[model samples]
Target chain A: AQSVAQPEDQVNVAEGNPLTVKCTYSVSGNPYLFWYVQYPNRGLQFLLKYITGDNLVKGSYGFEAEFNKSQTSFHLKKPSALVSDSALYFCAVKEGGNNRKLIWGLGTSLAVNP
Target chain B: EPEVTQTPSHQVTQMGQEVILRCVPISNHLYFYWYRQILGQKVEFLVSFYNNEISEKSEIFDDQFSVERPDGSNFTLKIRSTKLEDSAMYFCASSGRTSGNTIYFGEGSWLTVV
Candidate 1:
């Protein structure tokens, strides 16, 4: 079984400030974690993924996420936020092995203000 | 860069009517999937298709739901009879090999069941 949780419904950050959107997951086996962003009236765009190896994975548009095994978390971060970065973000997990279906979080709305 | 494309960006159908949502995945991708996001809800996986057959499906993919790669370029999801609760944004995604690989999603088709 696999599940992902994004506890925050929304997160606000000032432009040019660091921002973080939290994500936690539970999987019976190793997990393939991913982050995706969705702009208004647009489809989900892949941000980055954590399959193995490095705990810190860099992704598109200067965004990155750290996989913390001890905490069972994968949090998306950006050193400097931009107003254009504001969008709905989702965390997804696919349990290792043959489970090809992705279990997604409820999503968090990020609002970067200038 | 190649991308997954979906048709009927928006569709409205009456209850009990059958509807087919279509997608054209990236040309080189092999695995295809369908997911739906109801308003204010998390994205839920429906099914995964490969080699002209369903590889895996979630509980949400019932007898009323069916998927097929009707031709070389198109993948389709058919709902036998839509209910009001069936209204949602359906996303089509594709991946090259494994669940660990990056999956690209289409812009999604909005189905409004009336």
Candidate 2:
């Protein structure tokens, strides 16, 4: 079955340090990958998505993700972490074509300490 | 920027009672979706609505669940009889005319069943 995996349950980083949240996906066709973030008591917020073009896709809040087809990975990354970035991050994917439902990864809790 | 909107940011109900969650998708979006996240769990798709009908649904979207676009602006999800297991954060989302567009989500409605 098509699925997404966020291998890390939690990632910790010092403020201003680079941070990464790993994600890998398996699907039958071209994958449309996405990243979302949820702050406590708030709804999931769209971060970035990879549809076709450049492997490096930039999103809201200084976040970006690299889509690596060979590795079947689309990892979320930020050049510099902020305490405000501490939250739960999710990776989701849907196969290209008419598929409407998104296969989601168990979220990764990111804590950027000051 | 336009965004989806949901009502009753939080609701508490007794088991076996019916509950309706309301949403207002982005004005121009043609595709609507409902998803849920059990506390600390991966987001799960429940159903997708398009052209005034359900286009897709997950196994979790059983007979107990129903969706309607009840007019031009409001989309709703009705649970015929709520269960304790139904306690979750229900998100309402929408996308552009085509499936390739990004789905934007609303601040979810939290349902607490007792």
Candidate 3:
């Protein structure tokens, strides 16, 4: 079975400062990694994904992630934090072999201070 | 842009009551999925449907749960009998069913089993 881990329960950063939400995973064969953001009372919105490609993948809302296979990590990063970016972020992984299942991590709450 | 949509933003039901959550996936997507998130917990995959049949399911999706694409557009999750533990936000998602594809999510339906 595949699994994802989001070590932080919450992260705080000042507006205009860069921010990072870390994610790691364990799966068989290759891994399909993804990032998502959620606002209160809403569902998750896709941020980015890492398939078989270059290590670095860019995503929506000015965010990007680097797939480090050796580290088993796909961390979400933003150049600059915004007050509006405060929300819950989740990391997910799907089996890259023959399994068609997705495993998710407990979301990390992000707070951007003004 | 096209996205998955779930109805009944909130549904409150008594224990042992049957509830069917409805969803309409993206028009062009071929794979549909159901997931649930308990308060302060990780989002758990319930089931995955494709070609009008279940492609995959998790432990959480057992005899008590069933999914159906009753029509061309609507997909539904039926809970045979509700329990207090079932109270959570249920989200519907859809994807293009390609390798390493991205999945779009619905706003989610908050189900509270009293």
* Candidate with better DockQ, 1 vs 2: 1
Q: Write the per-residue lDDT of candidate 3 for residues A6-72, one digit (tens) a residue.
A: 9999999999999999999999778999999998777899999998889999999999999999999
Per-residue lDDT of model 2, residues B47-68, tens digit only: 9999999999999999999999
lDDT of 3 at B23: 99
The stretch of ten residues in a row with the least summed lDDT in candidate 3 chain B is B95-104
Summarize candidate 1's per-residue lDDT along B1-114 as a digit string, tens digits: 899999999999999999999999999899999999999999999999988899999899999999989889999999999999999999999998766789999999999999
Superposition error at A101 for model 1 (Å): 0.8
Model 1, residue A60: displacement in angstroms?
0.2
The regions of model 1 sitting more than 4 angstroms off are none
Model 1 chain B weakest lDDT span, ten residues long = B95-104
TM-score of 1: 0.98
Candidate 3 chain A worst ten-residue window by lDDT? A94-103
Query: If scored against the real structure, what TM-score would every candidate get?
Result: 0.98, 0.98, 0.98
DockQ for all models: 0.90, 0.84, 0.78
For model 3, the stretches where C-alpha displacement exceeds 4 angstroms are: none
* Candidate lDDT (C-alpha), each: 0.95, 0.95, 0.92
Model 2 agreement with the true structure over A1-114: per-residue lDDT tens digits? 999999999999999999999999999999999999999988888999999999999999999999999999999999999999999999999999989899899999999999
Model 1: per-residue Cα lDDT at residue A81: 99
lDDT of 1 at A58: 98
lDDT of 3 by residue, B1-114 (tens): 998999889999999999999999999999899999998888999999988899989899989999999999999999999999999999999988685789899999999999
